[model samples]
Target: MGFTNENAGYIAAQTAKRFLDAGYSVRGTVRKLASARPLLEDGLKEYSQAGKFEVVEVPDITVDGAFDEAVKDVTAIAHMASPVSFFFKDPEPVLHAAINGTKTILNSALKAGPQLQTVVYTSSITAVKSAKEPHYVYDESDWNDYAEKEVERLGKDTPGPIIYSASKVAAEKAFWAFREEKKPSFTMTAINPVFVIGPPLIAPKTESAVGETIRLIWTVFSGAPFPLPVNGFNFTVDVRDVAALMLYIASSAAGGPQAIADILRKELPETRGRIAEGNPGKGYNKEYTVPDGEIDINSEKGKALLGGWIPYEKSVVDTAKSFVGLV
Candidate 1:
């Protein structure tokens, strides 16, 4: 489920593909039925023809009972609908939308009752990291409560990045709190990813974060000044891997590490770079380092829940290849 046709296509299309491959029918929600082109792309049309895929229109996700009908017979929910662009002038609306939209879905799920087993929400690394202070390492236990307070202090004037980070924090915090308060029968899990980058299922016409990230690398190939951030590196994950993780969690049994009902971290790469090494302005900006401890990709939990990490290098290559002529 997503706001625009293109915004959620990358992960949504991939998630549907994973389920279709496993012989499970999918009922996805879209804001506008007319704009849902990505889901019908590739061989999904065949799945639709076979009656394995269907989409219901849910124009407003923040409204109560928005997903009541969508969840009627479905066994699971992948609540991926959230704002991506941080260009909004005011933070309150974004915060409200994030918190309220999540509540609306969970409420509908509760109304749907026992059939719904799990809900895998797409969270972000923003929910875990402290925007003001740098940490040596971060894990599932970390929460971005500081960022939420920062947003409250600054209100509408909060920076786009801060508001965007706080939105995730607020939404995820609301989810856990709702689970504790409501104690609904279904299990809930969050896949907290950082700067998702990979080949989109369908290449987008307008430049998006995924498109722009791939374009940044193209600048290096053309010998343009590719400004590699000198301060800190963002942890990155392949979109495919994140979608697969969602599927694994949604379909897996109710026990093991997932039984604890906590947020699961996506695998991280060792380093980050877009352009050539030793560029003129590489080390000039000394903001602070964003620390990440190594994720045990081979650990029992990871091995059991996710198809192992897709290397960032491959993600970069595939992203570049996907936009070969368009970019």
Candidate 2:
């Protein structure tokens, strides 16, 4: 089962299409059968006449044994069903969900380790570093300093967004711990995407990274209540690229976690961008630039293994057009 959103779902759909085209049976897991029906119907209509798309309902990730029955008979699993939200009054729920969900999935994978050859966990750049430091650059090696985060929480001033970053850090740390202790037989890989944006496979109603990006663009151009962050920038990759990378890792005989990190390093530069397409509002003199002193994730290792990392410039343009109804 995979998480579906405008950005991620589009990529997931594309991935599913590729697999189905190769004549592999595809089953998608959804939290709600009713909400996922549209995606299922569309997949059936677009991908195949054989109705190979199957949807299995799973318990909430926060609950134990949520994936017990779901993982049965599955050769490989891509754990992508985690919380991705920035608007939270409290971080406890989001943090618990992310950490607990990962634990649940990893535990289940360990139980199914004998049959499973590989499992790809979808992580994020949020886990790698934070945008708080204006002059600091971040790369794959730079882990977010959660210790500093705790200090901030105790300080007089604390921003809610920091909670999101903290959650990612904790979850990633938990993942590594689980890996080290249990050392499951199956190979594990994690894909950490920056600001993932692309075309939507399911459409606007779906809450996805793609949809959220479009909403941000609309807020910028339409002169909404909130203004775009002038100093805010994100590393991005095309949903297609991410999906392809995930599939490659899952299917490849040689690729591993290090290989995935290598790919990310080579691809980071082309991915950084401002939240909006055009210039900032008046008096917003500061423009977002790639921070210096941060670790560069695009390394020779990534370049050698993943070939060339391609940026999705067209995907960005297409995303803008979709929001403006020009697509």
Candidate 3:
């Protein structure tokens, strides 16, 4: 799902690659078949065999029964797609798309019957925690009720991040609620990934064509002012890890933008003057960068999910090299 998403495109393709690599057929869902088909096909061209991959359109994901036919006979599902547009200025559309898109899938999954043994939901760290929270360790049980309250109170005035936080919370809640109430045969699980970083699996044609996260990294790496104001929350995981599974804070933090600049300069000499040296001598301090609410992670659990973590340094360097290689 969301095979064309700026952030999730790689996830979708990589997920498809894993499935196709294992000799299973994959059916990807998109809002528009014409625009997304070629992109997904091209993205998975290396690993997907002729009859092993196909795409179907589910133009309106918010509607009930939208995924009925798409879900038919499928064994497992990775619901990584969402219907919300990137311009999340309006809360109503965001809420509707997030909640309803999730419901529609659950409804279709139920309609698919016992054949569907698993439904792995694509959830964000936003669903688990909010930027507004102080430094504290968070685990899977936590919920970002702060963002939901703000969305309810702030409406269109809410900040973009908070709005996104609220939407993820609501949608994932909707997903779990359906599972608990319906008790469908599929095992319902939501993978809540933090700031995702790494080189794009599919090379973008232009700098402006990269995903939102990489775009943010590019803004800082190119010595350009942020296209928008970003906060100082920088905890991160690699995009490849997120797909196989699944940064904002700044200076002196783990996965910080300044860290990206420094790595580029150290690993790629060409960045000497091309990228600004915001700060030097900083190290990757996970505890220092841990959000105020804190975090609780099981080394074994995380390894099982992403097959072990990809170091943030590698993710940063690879992202820079990818952008430089972009046409």
Candidate 4:
């Protein structure tokens, strides 16, 4: 239940739509209801939402009791409000916001009463294990203890990506630990998504908008050079799937950001000249140019499906269509 006037955000807006379409009355939280509500409502106009949808102001989610009133009557919750851009050199602020903001929501959920059943948190795959060089396959049993240690030893000197991974590692542990200690009746599930990219449901047409992950693709379409390592390192989950909490990625699937650049070049005419012509067929798995000592991690699709996922190409095309005029 997070939104901003300028950036309603893809996952946030889509999560709200999924709930509303499923007939749950939603009481979303916003910092400023005046501007955010109109945009959120406008974005959901396509749905014949069965239940009422409304929003309230919860100025700061990190504050204690911030969600008390907002969550009082809800049964299930999808909490994806933590920011990913807090790449501050100071880990305290990042840690505090991620950890404390998580507790604040769970605390409110605890007080929300006996009907509450599940609280799905938007966790990162980094929470499983950081994708360091010599990438390895990670299963459900792995925890990113490496990031925690690296951050601790390096302190502010730790890379921002590691710190991000560390915070998720910390926050998800904190989530499960709270459950084990407190033994709340409601179950908690953390959805760990890898590099989230897809059509942004609510991002504006402006190229400068901050929230959509697809904007990275925009940078490429605008003639920026390939913005990733020669062999791209990211595995993606669609923002909509992440929002819906329907991911089923096993430890054996492997595609990266470079795949998107290639997809865009093939699908979007506007990007034909603007995007780079990487080795085309030989890009992924380095049938073309494998980096020295690099390894690939693979994953199978998860068995469960809230319907199969949106294919990456469709996600890419729709994302490009969403920004149709901007190039």
Which candidate's TM-score is highest? 3
Q: Is candidate 2 or candidate 3 better by TM-score?
A: 3
Candidate 4 — which residues are off by over 4 angstroms? 1-8, 45-51, 131-135, 210-212, 230-232, 246-253, 256-258, 285-303
Model 3 spans > 4 angstroms off: 1-8, 46-49, 83-87, 131-135, 225-232, 246-253, 283-300, 304-307
Question: Whole-model Cα lDDT per candidate?
Answer: 0.62, 0.54, 0.68, 0.66
- Give per-residue CA lDDT, model 2, range 57-163, as digits (tens): 77477677777766766677777766665655566676788789888888877666466777777776666754454445445676767633663564423344566
Q: Which candidate order results from sorting by TM-score in descending order?
A: 3, 4, 1, 2
Compose the digit string of candidate 1's lDDT tens values, residues 1-327.
211122445677778777877888888888887666555655388887788888878888889998898888778888888876656668877887888889998889888766678887887767876644433445566677777788889887888878888899889989899999998888888877655666776765554434532444444432345454423223456777777785321111111111111111111121123223333323222221222342211122433566456654566556655644543
User: Model 4: per-residue lDDT, tens digit, 102-191?
Assistant: 888888888988888778777777788554556455655667778889888999898777788788888888888889988999887776
Q: Where is model 2 more than 4 Å wrong at Cα?
A: 1-23, 47-51, 131-137, 151-158, 205-210, 219-226, 230-232, 247-306, 310-312, 324-327
Per-residue error for 107 in candidate 2, Å, reads 1.2
What TM-score number comes out for model 2? 0.72
Per-candidate TM equals: 0.78, 0.72, 0.86, 0.84
The sequence of per-residue lDDT tens digits that candidate 3 reaches over residues 231-304 is 43466677766666631111112456666666777888877777777656454344334443444332246665
Cα misplacement distance, residue 41 of candidate 2 (Å): 1.2
Using lDDT as the yardstick, the better of models 3 and 4 is 3
lDDT of 2 at 277: 27
Q: Give the TM-score of candidate 3.
A: 0.86
Residue 276 of candidate 4: its Cα lDDT?
A: 77
